[model samples]
Target: MRALPLSSGSVLIDLHTSWNSANEIPISTTLAYFSSSFRQTRRGRKGIASSSTPLSSSSSFHSNSSSIRKPSDRFSNGSLVSSSTPLLSLSTSRELELFLELVPLRMRNELLKHDELRTLIEVVIDLGRKPIARFPTGDWVISDETVKLEDLHHAISKVGEFSDDNRSGIDHSLHRISAIRNRKMQIIGLTCRFGRAISGNAEMIRDLVEGGGSILVIGRPGVGKTTLIREMARMLADDHLRRVVIVDTSNEIGGDGDIPHSGIGRARRMQVPNVNLQHNVMIEAVENHMPETIIIDEIGTELEALAASTIAQRGVQLVGTAHGMTIDNIIKNPSLQILVGGIESVTLGDEEARKRKVQKTILERKGPPAFTCAIEMISKTEYRVHHRLDATVDAILAGKLPRFEVRRVEEKANDSVTTIVEPEKHSLHESEVTEKEYNTTQIEPTEDFIEYPVRRMIKRSNTKPSSTRTLPVCVYTYKILEADLLQVAEVMGLENDLNVTDDIGTADVILASSSELKQNRWIRSVAKFHKLSIFVIKVI
Candidate 1:
């Protein structure tokens, strides 16, 4: 690199490439090439742009430098301030000052709704005795002019008095302000446990932040989905350093007075109260605000989703919360389906579709058109992500929705480990039996009648004499069904009752355990038709 001086514009080249005959290239081309190359490099290396220009193999070293300077440029050092570390050594108070300065004027009244001056101090304050926090070279300081505390309080008081009319709106603005403060201070990231942040929809957030995809959290009212979204926002802002902004429609993200109640480690955050300008905001954030990520809470209306989709098309990262549980719930919402493009209906073959069933009662009762997506859940803590797994709706109709589980292991003493089981089962339809197959008869048992009868012979004297008829004594055993096994097992405790076969219409007694009962499904049918009483034991 070499230096040059020109009045209007100037170009300089590095002659170290060993070729002196090369014509000078336009500075704009060099800058454009640098920008384009930097982007490619940044993408390849996790967004860290580095110049990979090859050095010339020549021996001669010649460089050129240029500067188009004005007379006042005598003091200019041409140093560029790097934004790589925005919060480095930045004090809390300093951040607060910069925030106050950057906020749009129209919303300032709402953001500063709390502090007010007392009546006693208004008389002594001069016109210039006002407090303002300023930042020069990104370092914050209060103005040098001496001012009474009452003067500053008066300004705060004015905003507070004006905000009482729209207390709710003002409060929301304050929360938005607070959120920005914490992001600047890096507070929320300084707190919280890993894997303990979300419930019922944790995977959705994880996928959005880590899966290189976008996400929307939707559920019925009181499911606390938005709260989960806020925690995610905090996680991203505090931990990821990914620029996040909340287009808070209901003032939920930003708490009272432009302050976010929960800190999301966002470098920049803006709140628009009762905003009808969502598309404008999204465009502004990307075009002017330079946000890498954006978050909006409760995208309830059709217009909001439309604007959100537009924002998505611009290649900015988005995370949002909506209301609904199933994809049908989402489509029925009208606004959401239109915004994200409604979930596609699945088609299936007759043999494959026969096994499918609706899992939710709400969806079953008032089902909407089908949508293409997957559903997963490992624990109550989170639900799994759903997406189009196959090419056609028929695949989904075939009950081919992808299911996944997260395994957790617990360790005991001596490093003994036990795995917690998370079973993922497919949604299936149950076959119904007809009424003609049901048995309506119930035979009453006589008093003292035993379910299993066995006669124990007690011999008075060990005599084997007297008209003893020699006959073959045959022993028979029958297996019982699961239902009958449990019923008979409840009557016998700590032992299998094999001695009660006399009245059972059998010479031998046999009691079956649950395991045996399952293997013998014909026991109930056999017992019912043959009028035989069987006692079955249950195995644990």
Candidate 2:
């Protein structure tokens, strides 16, 4: 096969004469065919070639009349190829050619010639069964030939060995080939999935990515979470010049090789040796690499979530994707809940309950979220952004639907357009508790809600009114020795006034040992919401 560049920035791929005739094809053509197919396929699309001309003879190679247009640009105006078939102009089929190379030669040519290769999602090959091609539009085409053990072995030999996850990927390519093994661990089936590195996929959330806050992207499988993350890593490293590191667990983000793919730009990648040890690698990236930002994909474990929080607390920005459709889903998952500040049951005082008009025992955020912002990928082109993670979670816990901004990317006049639909302010009702709840209770004659007590505490003592004197400060100590705390309080002549308590709700201050505070995030968050004074005690 030979590739020739055209004036229109496209390339023309001329398949070898042997490929034209099944009888003349050689077994050695398998590997070369896979390599050349992807190289030419990417060039055809990225170069924007209007046509791909198959050259049979030397004379016909130079003949313009023999060229066939790619047919993709012609369908750019949203015209259907047939009444039932819609054109997939936005889809990339470079990986499809690589997948096609793995099937038997006779069946491969037939499947390749299909008009809907661009929309092909996966190819299923099983022993004694006909090879099946699947498309995103729910279309399936079965091959005439049955898949044999030899065909499966030939395909496996071309790719890297399958990992413990039963997944293998093409080197320097996004295509993934997963194995289905029998009871004896013999490969019985293969699922060839096409993975595309889509550029500009992160444009919908570009602003949030560039804002420098930790962002957690949530979506169902195959919704382009990894694709968007690849783009974000590239944009941040190349455009913004940030020191970005990707914790590539399965080589999915950076492709399947020791050398990272160019799709990630200048971003550094740390490959995890095992899927189970992904959390350790995440922490390693922070301590050893000193990256300004860390990008992790599919944070599904409790340890990984805790590691993510640890990285965020150290002031390194985190860009991660998780297995969930929305923020609420992650909150409900015990193992992954730490990513969004694990949920906890807070027992509100009778006064606090009556004021908010909720039950005494209510679900509350455990701590400040590891991620400051969350994005729900509704579809490949649509996203629901919870710009403020804390407020959104709080609202959800209060039995109120949190308002989210909708961002959509649409193709208009051949240009990608991003439209942000903000929720109408008027549409948001007052949170379940209203001013009427507070009004119903009679206020004590001498007591008043002194808002901004912290600010008042900073003022000169003489400027404060005698009647509004500060009360004894109750303290909750975590990991700090209670005896040491009392000794210090006594030395400062405030032991009677600074009493330590076990109840978080009754405490006026929380004196947490820094080491213990890192593990118990819920305690820190409860103190924050209660507006209690927090003092971190570091022990040598």
Among all windows of ten consecutive residues in candidate 2, which has the lowest summed lDDT?
438-447
- lDDT digits (tens) for residues 1-540 of candidate 1: 333434434333332221321222223444444343333323322211122312111112123324332321211111111112122211222223222322223223322332221100101122244233211222121334544444334333322221211222222122121111133532121000011122223333454465534556556553455556667677666766677777655454554454444334343566563356665665677777766667776677777777767766677767776666654455456566654354443444555334332111111111221222323223334454544312212222222222323333243567634433353433322212123222111112212212322211112112242364222222234553445433443454311332324233444323444455445434443344334444444332
In candidate 2, what are the lDDT values of residues 181-261, reduced to their tens digit?
999999999988877777677876778988999999999987888988999999999989999999998888987878776
* Residue ranges of candidate 1 with Cα displaced over 4 Å: 1-208, 343-380, 387-540
Candidate 1 global lDDT = 0.38
TM-scores of the models, in the order given: 0.35, 0.63
Q: Among all windows of ten consecutive residues in candidate 1, which has the lowest summed lDDT? A: 187-196
TM-score of candidate 1 on Cα atoms, chains taken together: 0.35
